[model samples]
Target: MKVVVRVKLLPSPEQAEALQATLHACNRAANAASGVAFTTGATHKFALQQHVYAALKVKFGLSAQPAVRVIGKVADAYTTRTAHLDKGLLGHKGSKRRARSEATPIRFRPDSAQPFDDRCLSWQLDARTVSIWTTRGRMKNLAFTGSPDQLKALAEHHQGESDLIVQDGMWFVSATCEVPEKPLNTEPTGFTGVDLGIVEIATTSTGQRHAGRILNRYRRRQNRLRAKLQKKNTKSTKRVLKRLRRRESRRARDVNHMISKSIVERAERTGHGIALEDLKGIRGRARQAKRNRYTLHSWSFAQLRDFLTYKARRAGVPVVVVDPAYSSQSCSECDHTSRRNRPSQAVFACTGCGVVMHADTNASRNLARRGEIVWNAGRSVSRPCPSL
Candidate 1:
């Protein structure tokens, strides 16, 4: 498993200036490289590097490694842009959005993140400082700080490149760590079905519910404040808006971590696997009212699912994703599938079996049952051997 550990970089005034200049120069070089790639159709890393590598070192004051990294970054951005375009994420064919995207080369922001490999960036974990290459020259003894767990992970498993990111005038290095995964648990007592929703956030088949009411209330307040700030359009208000950019998201992320930890711990203790709903294209397929659209888009169900997956993996608990087509509408008691089963959002009353329960709980039970069937099918290998 790969994890990113972010630590704050505490640089002095002069060091900060050098870091800032380095970022600007790297991004400028990336922009130039992007233009060359667009015109010559040399989007591959080595192909683009052949065109702009020397120029980056000469004109942008980048060293050999920084210049190479800049070219690689440009190549990656174009690859991602091309992929998104191919996937119809920008827009449909002949649409204005697609046309505009196709017409121009990609560009990078001046303060965009720049990656540094071991050659250009060396960590001094014990000293809590880093020696990094800069446009101004090699800078050393740059102080950094992180939580104990983060520092430990960096010292133990940190590998590969680290991104130098500047946000809200604060510098950070997001270092990648490769953590070993535990062996899979082949025999689980049962599967715990988790049904995700906007209102309840997550509900287990065992009747445990994590409500999203508090988080939703917080987001609404933040939205109102953001609207007022946008209406004012003053310099101070803009600063405040910048400061508050990720407050709501940070809160949501913390909440997700807590909820996922609780659920995974309980499952591990009970020797049960996790079963999640496969909601891959829900955003594109589902419709929402005007008033509910914001809530639908703002909720981070995907993030929660990711948390659950990684935690379960580390804990050696198995996980399965089941089809959720009629999980809510189907009765968990008598296997009766009907739209009338869910007459209300919170209440589930089966017309066939006359069983009453919470709608989310019922859906979760159906998912759990389906997950067991899938697990059992995977375990069976009773087919005749092929003749060789």
Candidate 2:
């Protein structure tokens, strides 16, 4: 299986400048290719390559591989926008009318990672440095470091593209690495259902809670800071806002990673499958009562789910995703479904069974039971089941 391992990249100021120029040049080539791709219906990577490869190299000073990579970048952008319709869902025909053939001139995002080839990129463990091809020429011996564990991974088992990216004024090399696939997880011996929510990052059927108090508290503080910064409308304020945004994102990502790792470890230790709600489009579909929308809307349920998946797989624990509908309202004890049963966000008292429990925990228990059922039936966990 392929996994992306992101590591810090410390480059000389001159190297950074060269890298930025290469990014701009390639993005310019990509925009030019995007326009032609849409017009000529050359959206496929191979076709886009055929149409733009020669011009990209000549017009943008991109070498052969980098020029081809530009076409891939545009193709990916187009592919991402069409992925929803490409899933081959039952009985769904594609749109009868096509989008405007005219492609918008796409600008390269500063955060865009330049793809690397073995010829273009190399790493040296002895020096803790990276060598990368840049616009001016090949840049050798740029310094980098990461956590000891990350450095260890870089030194061992690193594979695929180590694309260079810049974030919040720091450079990073995101590399795809190979991991040995665990034998398909055995049938679940038991299940631990996890309910992901805003107030609590996660609540398990076993009654363990990963609280969101710190996360929510931090976000509230961030919002206040951003509000004050936005009122000024000055360059310095803009810079502060950008920095604040990066800090909050990093904080949330770290917390979710910790929570997911803990949850997966717990399941592995207990020899149980981890059950999670099918949370696709959760932000768009779910509604929080008045005054709670901001808190619910911004939380990272999706990221937590993804982290749980990979971690659970690595530990040889099955991850079962079950239907999310009525998960919060349904009573796990009695199988009763009612909105009234859940009196508030935190408490659940089932009218049918008279069983009282933490609302999120009850939901998690329901998810856990549903997951076991799905696993026993030997079905894929991704598809949503309405009655589970």
RMSD of each: 1.9, 5.3
Summed over model 2, clashes come to 0
Weakest ten-residue segment in model 2 by summed lDDT = 94-103
All candidates' TM-scores?
Answer: 0.94, 0.88
Instruction: Provide the overall lDDT of each model, using Cα atoms, as 2-decimal numbers.
Output: 0.94, 0.82
Estimate the lDDT of model 2: 0.82
The pairs that clash in candidate 1 are none
Tens digits of per-residue lDDT, candidate 2, 67-146, equal 87778888887776567346533224643322221224344564576787677789888888888887898888888887
Q: Write the per-residue lDDT of candidate 1 for residues 178-271, one digit (tens) a residue.
A: 9888888999999999999989999999878999999999999999999999999999999999999899999999999999999999999999
Candidate 1 lDDT score relative to the true structure: 0.94
Model 1 clash number: 0
Q: Which stretches of candidate 1 lie over 4 Å from their true place?
A: 385-388
Instruction: Show model 2 residue runs off by greater than 4 Å.
Output: 82-107, 379-388
Error of 2 at 60 (Å): 2.0
